[model samples]
Target chain A: MKTAIDIENVSFAYNEQPVIRNVSMTIESGDFLGLIGPNGSGKTTLLKIMLGLQLPDSGSVELFGTPANEFAEGTRLGYVSQHSTDADSMMRVTVREVVEMGRYPHAGLRRLTDKDHQIIDDALKTVEIEEYADRRISNLSGGQRQRAYIARALASEADLLALDEPTVGVDADVVDQFYELLTELNAEGITIVLIEHDIAKVSEYAETMACLDGELYEHSATSEFLKSGALERAFSSARAVSSRSVTRGD
Target chain B: MATETTRQRRELGAVALGIPLVLLAFIVFVVWVFPPLFELFWNGMEQLFNEHWLVSSSFLQHGFTAGVLIGFTAPVVGSYLVNRQMALIGEALAHTAFGGVAIGLFVGASIPVLNYPLLWALVVAAIAALGMQYIAVNTDGYADIPIAIMLTGGFAVGIAVISYGVVFSATVESYLFGDILFVPFENVQLMVGLTLLVGLVVGLTHKQLKFITFDREAARLARINVWLYDTLLIVLTALVVVAAMQILGAILVAGMLVIPVAAAMQVTNSFNRGMLISIVFGQIAVIGGILSSYYLGIATGPMIILVAIGIYLLAIVR
Candidate 1:
């Protein structure tokens, strides 16, 4: 099987405080990876490293057999970050324009072609936001705005979607719809790597789970994570409570 | 989405905001600066006009050109800087250019080989602009701290040169507070070229710039070079700041960059519309300020800024 990501003994720090400590992990192609940890356990930092936004202090990351630093084909991967909605309100472009920005990487000194426009419209329809295509993004609801960002990522036509807390500030009812949309996209076979603080929540969608507590245990399946005491040893009290909440009906 | 009626109303509001500039310019030119001089030079100008047809006084020509170009260019770039919430950087770079002006003056006095104050200002201001970004990135200081440091550091150097008596221009007080009296035709040509370059580059990269400003991290994720665009935006800002100093002056160019864009935002619904409206407001400020300065014998920079403020107040009310 082709490996989608290969991280080797990576460690990182900020202002002399260590974050990711000698963590190694591999995510195979087509695997939905759920990276979960405590609030300060550096899940977002790790995600940033995987996407080449920030370089790790030591060790290396290989994306699709190319080193993260040398990976020239960034359009092959899509990313949605936290606070994306906040930036949306400051800009005055329409939702369609916002989604079309995803084509910039491929457009490359030329205007969008018919195929690019078709892809953008398709992405918006996939996210069910074709209604607000002409409307400014500032007018959209939080969930709808997030969908716009997803449409932006989707418009890139990437094979891998790496989202950092996509549902952090969104309301609960919308979050279910958001996750359902993700599942639908996953059903279409795009690989997903989602970062979350709660293992229980992400375990619902992720087949493979990595519990990071300054270090990584990447090979645990969701079923083993629930049955084994491995999570109790690696996580803080918050995860323990969330773990109980997830296992209650089971 | 704004309906057609609302859009028409918004455009009307922008034009209305622009009306006072016309009145102020009319009062300044017809009432004050040109009364005695217009009488003395009217026949000479008319005869020259008959021969050359475009014959105008260097002052009027330079002032008119500077006012219009600054009007068109300042707010286009200013809108991006304002939307990014980096308005202070504009102020800082102007001071850097001011220091450059001082350096140019001093060098011309001591060396006599080099003498263009405006060109020197551009060079130093560009360096200072890039330096501020460098300081902000390489150091642990706050973002605004680098700006604050550059702001005062550049001005402190300028003040020191003035105090040393090496760079003070006693006759050209207009250089201190902005005046059209001393602007040579050659300098107007420079402003014209600079305006064209700034306008062209900005027009080409506007969409990419919009993306970078909207969400830098997302832009980076999508393979946009965030650092390159950020540097480009700041460097372009430095160029505009240098270009605007002829009318708004160094002490007051920030007003041109910020106020017009602020006022325009109140009247328009979208980014591109707001930017277009901002250029209109900026033109009003410049034309009105130049006219008033010529007639009333007031400082042009302050006059322009005050007009912009009044327009801003009116925009808020509407």
Candidate 2:
């Protein structure tokens, strides 16, 4: 299997205190990788470093074999941020317009061609939100908005998808649906790197798991992870009990 | 759009209705008590709407052409500013242009070689915009910090120059509120060129500008230079504001940049359509204001803005 992401001995600091210290992890291609931790556990920071949105104080990130800083193939990697709506809602734009923005990186020499439209429509169909394509984005529900974002990621036609707390403001039921959609996409041969705080949801869909608490605790198969109690060190006792119960049920 | 309701159409009608009422008021005022202050175009009043084509007088020709050019460019660029919530940038640069006006007047009085205050206003406004962008980058203040600083600083320098009466007092009012009728052919030619430049730049970069305004981070991620687009937008605004100051007045310049977009926003659901509506509304405001001020003896700047305010009121009721 190809190595999709290689994060090496990375440490980042805010002011003086370290937020991410000596953390390293690797994601193999075709793996559904879930990264879970407590609040401020540097999960988002790690994702940012990989996407070149943030630089680590030490060590490095390699995306699909190229150094993150020198990686010029950004179009081959799809990213969905948490604050996607905040800046976008300022303009009066439709869902189709937002999804079309994904093609901008690859829109060379010509405007959106017939092939591009087919892909965009397929992305919408994949997310099952095709009916809302012409509606203004601000008019959609939270789940619908996430579906639109996922469609944008799909439209990029990248093999790897990186999500940063994508289910942040979603309800419990909606989160289940979101994870199920991720599982379906993962089964369809896309490598997914999901940064989530919901341990229950992450355990249900992630084939491989990494526990982080400002430091890497373990990276192993989900079955091996569940056999051990690595989450105990990362989460509080109450959360550990509920998360264990949720994972055991899965 | 099919979604455009009857209420919206009626609200737009309210806006259209204001122009004729204003025109009637001017007509009654002209017939009631003829003011010699407008002895410039009192004759051939019957051709007031289409009189610019007649070229009946040089003043009317210059005034009408300048006003129409300003009408189009202000909203073309203003739509982006309003969407980005940077409408105050226009107000800031207009005041900064006043400082340029003061410098030109003083220098012209001393040297008698540099006599165009509007040209100086353009230079100062452009530099001030770039300088403010620089300060915004180096300072810890918010995005609007430079605009706020330039606004007060520019006005202070302009007011001080005039108060000192250092060759800036006698000709200050024309620059302050605009003297569109008295514009030289050279300045009118410059306005034409500036207006065309604004139109061309905006037309060429419309999608990129919209992308930056909509999502700067995403645009950056897509390899679009957000900084370059931001600078281009601000510089274009500087050009538009300086050209408009002499026709729209420095104090009222923000009105042209904001109110028409606001009115358009109330009616249109998309940014492109909103911009188109804004340009049309700006034309009505400028043209109607010019005709009213000519007939009723009022400052063209205030007259245009008052008509804009009436349009805003009509939009608000929707």
Candidate 3:
């Protein structure tokens, strides 16, 4: 019955051009929500508002019953940004060091304690990346790197995890495994919110769906929404390419 | 498994022995062999410590004063510069400060001594630095152009002022090359006071600066004042530039700010670790360069920078 995120009549614009208009939605705790829309349909922008990374011009957002701005430090929120890149070239830090950054809000200015190290190790283990703990992040494959990033989020002990197209550059096998991991985490009561374009595949993993179209189009149970042809319309405008056939008729 | 353990043990033993051997050799070289080989070295060093205390204290005062001020302030400003990928802005500001110093000299301000005239010159330099940032932000596809223009223009101004000087009593060479030996007591006191003020500001605003540096949009969304932190960073940079100019000279000041930080970033994964490494590496450069300069009779600032660059190169090679 606890609401994790609440947004009310939110609108956003960039350079005076509207991107999101009068949108409102509430996500409850333990919900696995998938946001689906075509490219540039304001899915990412809406997520940004939820993450408190961007402001809505005319509305308000609250996380865990507190105003977004008034949330206390060390509140369990995890974010994996689209623009997160490998650290600068001059750095030669290992995977362990990068994951340790997630502990920063909890342990300010002090060295990592034994408990922090245990959390980091456990997070790495949860991501199945304990083997790569000592390896440099740059040397890892794209899938491995993404897993490292997930470990960083896991290390934060976050109650809510927000990912922006986490499967963008990953291979099919890794993507499948990543979804499995997400489901496992969801089973453990961590709320998951993700913006994904692979609507057909993601519907199996996500329990709830929010279809965005410059506004909040629909928010309903994922299976029920898909059965009602919601996703078909969201991605219905794909252009088909025709191919000529030479057969026995000729 | 037993063989593997033994092999590891041997490697560890080698490291333990190798480190001590190197330290022993260095101690012997510093204490025993070098004194008689360079006879005048000990006498000059003795005189430097004895007669130069008044002057050394002044220089120490200057170095510590400037070091403490810049050490605390530049890093806060640097947090933004690193995030913005505008690290070169510090270099441009140093050059602009050079121009301010030239104009101050041409107007009959004392060159070697710290005075109100030099302070006003620093203010002009700070304004110029801010102006350059504005231009860079407003222009499209030419982020580095404004900085490049300021650098060249500032140097040209310095040249013109030096050529048209009325009567030159102090050699301009010392300022350009940096003569830490000439630092007076008053300058030292001023340096220390300024550094403390900068430190307090940085400490108080640490979280705000970090938020803006890592994610500006998020900082804005959280309703944390972005412009206030941005302006504070630039002003702090300008103050650090003026303070460091005495020890490293105008042309070389930016090197000290950037090189150690760059090196630290090479080996650390976290921002906090990078900062700690940078301070440690910077101190090493300062101490090593000073000792080498005193022994070899070379320029102190360049020596320090060379040591830092050497560390950077070693990190790269490894």
Candidate 4:
């Protein structure tokens, strides 16, 4: 199988404070990899690096064989950030307009054609938000807004989808539906890299799982990962360190 | 269902009216397909008004033409800036342009050939815009810090230049407090050219600009060259500021960029529709202010801004 993302000894620091240290992993094409960790495990930063949104302080990243810094095919990648739903509340944009942004990378400088419109419609339909297409994005519920973002990804025809805590503010039932949609898309041969705080929930949908606590603890199939106690080790290790700091403070 | 049908019909009506006008604007401004379109428009206005002095006089003609073009270009560019919460950038650029004008006047006192203050304003404003963009991107402080610095720093420079050179206070005051009667025919033509450049640039890069305005991180992820587009937008704002400074003055110029879009946003949910409506509102303000200023014998700059504020209040009330 072709590799979707290849990270080799990637290390990143914020103001000389290392956040990601000697972390390395490879995501194969069509893999639904759920990356779970405690808060500030550098999961989001790693995702951004993989998507070429940031540069690593050391080592390298490759997206589909090209160096991450040099990778320019934006059309093949779709990113739904953690703050996506809440960031543009003041913007007066319709759902269809938000979805149409997916096609922007495809139709640079030229007007959207009939085929582009058709793809956008298909994307909206896929997310089942065609009914709300004309409505203002700000007026939509959190669940509906996420669907709009997913539809945008669909419209872009992106083979790889990267989401950072995409269901943070969503309701419980809506989160399940959102993951089911991810599952369906993954089955349709799209590669998904998702960072979710809910470990059990992500493990249920993800075929592969990776745990990170400043560094990679484990990367394996979800079933094996659950049995291997890597999640517990990663979490307990962080807890141990925090408790040690507390004891020292006393 | 009835409301839905009405909304659809209204949308269709807007599209129908919009397409022709957009095509006309592109042809007239971008391609210069019909250089006589303005003459035809003025002649029609003169004939309709029975050869009134306001419509027949060449000074008023040039002033009105310049006003209408500023009305068109300012709000279109302002839509992006306002939505991005960078509305004050216009104010900053205008102040920098004022500085440039002061320098131009000082230099022109010695050299007759380099007397075009607007030309100098364009150069200084564009450079300051790029400098502002660089600082905003590279620094890690409050976004408004650079804006405040530019705003005050540019004004200080202008004041220093004016005081040192002993430039004519009357000539400087016209630019500071905009005189509609001061616009020349060549400036009107320059307005047309600026309008064309703005229209073409916005038309081509609307998607990129819209995407960046709504979400900077996503635009970067899309490899849309967020820095380049941000720079492009700031430069465009500078160009519009220089073009608009002739009629709106340094103080009120940002009003032409902010107020119309603010009012339009109050009424519409779609950015594209809001942009179109803002242009409509801008035209109304320009025309209303010019006519009111003519009759009331008030300053056209403040008159236009007050008209725009009135529209905003009305939109809010609605």
lDDT, candidate 3, equals 0.68
Stretches of candidate 3 off by over 4 Å are: A57-60, A65-74, A86-97, A106-125, A128-135, A154-157, A237-250, B1-84, B99-173, B192-236, B265-277, B280-284, B287-299
**C-alpha lDDT of candidate 4 relative to the true structure:** 0.88
Go through the candidates in order and give the clash count of each: 2, 0, 4, 0
Query: For chain B alone, what TM-score does every candidate structure achieve against the true structure?
Result: 0.81, 0.81, 0.74, 0.88
Candidate that scores best on TM-score: 4
- List pairs with backbone clashes in candidate 1: B32-B295, B33-B295
Worst 10 residues of 4 chain B by lDDT: B1-10
Docking level of model 3:
incorrect
**Candidate 1 root-mean-square deviation in Å:** 10.5
Total clashing pairs in model 3: 4
What does DockQ give for each predicted structure? Answer: 0.21, 0.17, 0.19, 0.31
TM-score of 2: 0.83
| Comparison by lDDT, 2 against 4, better one | 4
Output the better candidate (2/4) by TM-score.
Answer: 4
| Cα lDDT tens digits for candidate 3, A1-250 | 7999999999887766677889999999999999887666678888877866666887998888876655553227777656554232224447786677566445532346999999999999999999988877677776777787778777878888888888877898888898999999999999999888888778989999988766777789997887777666655532111121211100
Residue B25, model 4: Cα distance from true site in angstroms: 15
* Chain B TM, cand. 1: 0.81
Which candidate wins on DockQ?
4
**lDDT per residue, candidate 4, A118-224, as tens digits?**
99999999889999999999899888998898898889898999998889889998899999999999999999999999988999999999998789999999999
Docking tier of model 1: it is incorrect
TM-score of chain A of each: 0.90, 0.90, 0.90, 0.95
